[model samples]
Target chain A: MSSGLAQPRIRIPRSARAGEAIEIRTLMEHPMESGIRGANHAAVPRNMLSRMVVRMNGETIFAADLRNGTAANPYHVFFVRLQRSAEFEFVWTDEAGRSVRATARVAVS
Target chain B: MTTASRRALLLALVALPAAARADAALEAAMREAVGPAEPEEGGMALRLPALAENGAQVPLTVTVDSPMTAEQHVVSIHLFATRNPTPGVASFHLSPALARAEVQTRIRLAEDQQVVALAVLSDGRVLRATAETRVAVGGCLG
Candidate 1:
């Protein structure tokens, strides 16, 4: 909870047509250790970013439950249809109860 | 027990011997994702590179054929790497706000294996799809 999971990045188009689905991508840096092997050969004890939530304006649009098999540095791409300009909020929470938040705004025409 | 020690116990428990996976494990994972719902093999497409040389970070996509309106939309999408030490990969929950039933991410596979995707629709239908990838090197361990 003290340190790790460096800068997270999110990508979204600056503008989109009303009623059209727009793409959204997010990446968070973490080891996502599976804890499946023994001794030094194994991953260093099951440190994973366990959850992700994406919200439009204030309503949640997408969420994901991550696990050991989700690979190091979680990445996800999803879509949302816009009827008007809105702000998006993304939150990533790890198993140790640490969390990070980011936001982006999209202009809809 | 302290959370740290409990997690350490979990880590100790997962020190496993990766073995050949069985179909039942995949089915169990599917069942765990959605209680008592049998997934039908249609309405979803799982995209994975046919030959993924790097199993650590294989680009993957799962798209379900749904209008994604409030009347009828995907409730969630579950992914499984059947051959990994842990078969359950991830689960994505969707709402009409998403407007489309599609998602993309990266997954880790233990070996040449079949990956499955299950789409749980708002109308109580579970649609499924599977793809096979040949993994040259596993990323589970050094």
Candidate 2:
């Protein structure tokens, strides 16, 4: 198994002004391999770091389908409109049918 | 044989079986986690550090491009490491109302190996992505 590690360290403000959009920044460690070739001349198996969904106050904010063109350990930043304090959830999936998840909360002032 | 030779022989005999057992256990875990699945191109992204000096605390992230709409969303995500002691890193289940399709965390890379990600949508469509990482020695050697 290639370093069987997870990705992305996200930071979210604990609180935000009401009705104001809050910033959500995420940094994940990834190799983001093109899978053209593997180590030691062995054919690298096909895998993916595809699909991410973000929710704010239980509402979907952003989602995407990624590809080989993406760089390793992808970094993403986005904003969500906040009306009140709510739990933010983030999840990601890979090609080998694996998944990693994390959560953060923000208070709307 | 001298005492030193006898000790060396005994050590080898003991070490051989322990190593073999560990290898077998690891293999079984990999087979159970990784099933027969073709690589589906597109719809996923992996973010990793440009360079990792340590393999034990390598940070990783997986993101899938999907709308968490009532009609559509990501159901689950799977991660695999081909050369690690344990290939299956983690699996995630999403709540329909949660609607968050991205996950992030730190992982232990046994060595420098390619990592793969797969996402299953509520509609049953699967998306995939991959990334190769370099882990320095003395970092993941343990």
Query: Tens-digit lDDT track for model 2 on B1-142?
Result: 3488457656755888654443454445433433444446688888766566776556777778876566887776666664564455555555444334666655556567777777777776667777888767422233
Worst 10 residues of 1 chain B by lDDT: B15-24
After TM-score superposition, the amount by which residue A19's alpha carbon in candidate 1 deviates from its true location, in angstroms, is 1.1
Off by over 4 Å in 2: A1-12, A17-84, A87-106, B1-39, B96-100, B138-141
Specify the highest-lDDT model's number. 1
Q: How far off is residue B51 in model 2, in Å?
A: 3.4
Model 1 clash count equals: 0
Alpha-carbon RMSD of each model: 7.9, 15.0
lDDT of 1 by residue, A1-109 (tens): 2345576899999899999888898989888876777334354666778899998899988999998679899999998999999999888998988888888999998
Q: How does each model score on lDDT? A: 0.85, 0.62
